[model samples]
Target: MNQLDQLKKYSTVVADTGNVELIKKFSTQDATTNPSLILNAIKLPKYKNLLLKSIEYAKKKNINLKETVSLASNKISVDIGTKILNFIPGRVSTEVDSRLSFNKNLCIFHAKEIIRMYEENGIKRNRILIKLASTWESIQAAKELEKENINCNLTLLFSFAQAKACAQSGVFLISPFVGRIYDWHINKYNLDSINIENDPGVKSVKKIFNFYKKYSYKTIIMAASFRNINQILELSGCDYLTISPTLLSELKSNFNKIDKKLNFTIKNKTYKNKITEEEFRFEHNEDIMATEKLSEGIRQFGYDQKKIEDIIIKNI
Candidate 1:
């Protein structure tokens, strides 16, 4: 069996992209999307019409495209998300606005709006995971949303405290970024003085994985931001993993004999962590890499969102 096939014994593999057309070929269990992926997809010829269609539909209703294309793309995101769920038989993660990460009320409001849009289109709330950043406000907002039975996927996680905090909040899923971990190591150590086997990103996720498994945390850990297959293979048998399409394809093609390396059935283990709000704040503040990446990730997403909005305003 391919590495992807082998990893399936324990871990669920999710396709992390906005393009739904090729999702089935990957045999991904679920799909995830954010403004950046959606923005990238809009540029593709196949997806352009969808963006324009949403814009045109809004134009007909006199809804300002700039303000409304987000609504439109969100609707589009749900449509694609629901469609991919059909192919994979799992939950689809649709992200709320990254700009709203720090705005608790707005995050809750938009999360509900996205869920409502999905529901109207015949998708159920259970099969949808609202993606939020790992900010304190977003975490609080997610906890409130959970009270309403809305499952959330907290993304852009880096620190152990973030994972611990999210688990304590009882979120359905938490995606601790792997590749971004590598990014920090590369930037910090200049990439030349590092050992790939002992790479910081790899060690980071493994620690969280062991902690969650040892403690039996309810929040599933989906390792995200993988730069290569080595990272994925190293972190096999994780709760779930959101891999880019290219890596998924590459993994499928390279079936180098693999086995489930992560032992999930082990008895509960102890991780010296108390993932509270203040703990999360202090931990995040102390980790320069996490702090930098959080700001940089948010800014990049915010910039892309603005760029997409700008495009809609000029064209529609």
Candidate 2:
């Protein structure tokens, strides 16, 4: 069997793209989308109608320009997610606006809005994972949403503290950005290249995987933002690996036998105190890499979010 097929035996493969064609091609179990991916996907000729439809939907709301753009952005995300869901049997992760990441109440409200849009399209809440940033506010918002049976995927996760907080908050999943972590370490060390064995990104995911498995946390770890196939192969046994089309294509052609790099076996059960909000903030701030990358990820996503909104504004 190909490596992609082999990897699926160990971990659920999630397509990390807004392009439905690629998602269909990979046959990923689940799919994830952010502002950037959604922006890129809508640019393609195939999605022009999708964009037009979203604009029309937004116009019907009879809101102001700013509110109309917001509605259209949410509609585009949900529309793309709804389309992706038709191809994948599992859930689709539609991210909340990163601009609302710092506002717990806004985050909660936006998440529910996305869920409502999905449900209106005949998609069940269980088939949607409302993606949110890994800010403290977002985490708290997720905790509340979970109580209402709205599952969430915490994105832009870089620190162990973030992972701990998310799991403790009873989130459905957390996406630790593997490639971003690797990039930070590589630039910090001024290294030309790093081997997969010593890669910081790979190590981070492994640590989180072991910790979650040891404690038997039901919160899933879906490794995201991979730089290459080796990183994906290294995390073969992760709960889920969200891979882009480029890397997915690489895995699809490779026939190498990939071994499970992570496992559920824990010799001894371990326990730790629940992470407090203050502790999460302090520890996460201490990690320079996580702090910088988390901020950078949010800014990038917010920028892309605006770009999509601009497009909607132009058409509407």
Candidate 3:
């Protein structure tokens, strides 16, 4: 079996792209998409129709440009997610607008709207994971949403505190970024490169995995933002790993023996204390890498969100 097939034995492989066509080529169990990915996918010739459809939906709403842009953005995300769901048997993660990451009510409202759109298309809520940023507000929002049976994937996660908070909030999943963590450390220490075994990103995921297993937290850890095939190989036994099409292709071409790097048989001591909001903020603030990367990630996604809105305006 190829490395991709071999890795699936231990962890669920997810396609981290908005391009449904590329996702169809891979044997991914789930698909994840952010504003940036949605923007890129809509730019492709094949996905142009999705954009046109979004524009048409916006025009029917007859709202102002601001409201229209917001409506179209959610429409496109759900439209693409709906398309992806046809190819994969598992759920599709459609991200909330990063611009609303700090607003709990807005986040919840948008998430529900996205869910409603999916349901209107005959997709069940159980087959969808609403993606939100790992901000405190977003985490709280997810907690309430979960109560209503709306599963969420807390994303842009980079700190142990963020992971702990998400787990305690009873979120369905958390995507701890690997490549962004590695990139921050590389530039911080001015290192030429780090070995795969010693990669900071990989180590972060391992730590979270072990912690979750030790305390028996039901929240799933889906490692994201991998920079290389080796990083994916390093996280062979995570709950899930969302990989780009480029890395997915690389894994499909390579046939190598892989082993489970993480398991539930953790030997670490368990902790029963819940993470307070203040403690979570302080701990995450202390980690310079997480602090900077989280902000940077939000900004980048926000920029892409604007780009998508711009395209909608042009079509209007």
Candidate 4:
């Protein structure tokens, strides 16, 4: 069996792309897309049809030209996600606006809007995971949406505090960015070299996985944003791994035996610790890397979103 097949024995492989062809090639069970990925995809010549189709759909609905940016962005996501859904048997995550990361009400409002768009096109809510940044507000918004049977995938999660909050709030899944965490440590420490076994990003996910397992938190852990195959292999037994096409292709080419790296069992740990809003903020602040990465991830996504909106406005 190829490494990709072996990895699938232990984890559900998700394609981390906006390109339907790539997702189909990998036969990924699920797929995830963000503003950056969508923006990048529409810029490609092959995906230009998707971009034009989204704008046309919005225009036909009598959407305001001035607000085409927002509508175009949302339609593009749904259009891509709808396409992806036809190929993949499982869910496709469509993220809410990163600019609304801190606003609970707006996040909820947009999340529903995104889901409604999917449902309007005949995709059930069960097959969609609303992607949200791992902000406290976003988590709270996810909790409320969960009550209405809307599952969420919390992205840009960098710290244990964020994971704990998500688990406590009863989210469906949390995506801890393995590559981004490693990038921060390598740049900050100025390390000429580092051990993959002891990679900071790898360890962060391990910690969260162990805690979640030990305490029996039902929120799924999907380690994501991998820089290499080693990081993906390291978390082989995670609940899921959303991987890019580059690494997925690498795995598909290598017919090697992949070993499971994570195992879960109940251990000595208290599952219940009510984290107040102040404590949550303080704990997140104490982790320098998480603090910096979370903010940076939001800013970059917001910038990409704005760029896509600009493209829509220009087209109008």
lDDT of each: 0.81, 0.92, 0.93, 0.92
**Model 3 has how many clashing residue pairs?**
0
| Tens digits of lDDT, candidate 3, 1-316 | 9999999999999999988789999969999999999999888888778888988887798888898889988999999999999999999999999989999999999999999999999999999999999999999999999998999999999999999999889999999999999998899999989999789999999999988988878899999999999999888899999999999999999997888877677555657788998999999999989999989999999999999999888887
Off by over 4 Å in 4: 60-66, 267-270
| Per-model TM-score versus the true fold | 0.92, 0.97, 0.97, 0.96
So what's the TM-score on candidate 2?
Answer: 0.97
Name the candidate, 1 or 4, with the larger TM-score value. Answer: 4
Superposed by TM-score, candidate 3 places the C-alpha of residue 40 at a distance from the truth, in angstroms, of 0.7
Model 4, C-alpha of 225: deviation from truth (Å)? 0.9
- State the lDDT of candidate 4 residue by residue for 178-232, as single tens digits: 9999999989999765688889999999999988989878899999999999999
Clashes of each: 2, 0, 0, 0
Q: Identify the superior model by lDDT, candidate 2 or candidate 4.
A: 2
Tens digits of per-residue lDDT for model 1, 114-171: 8987887788899999999999999889999999999999999988778778888888
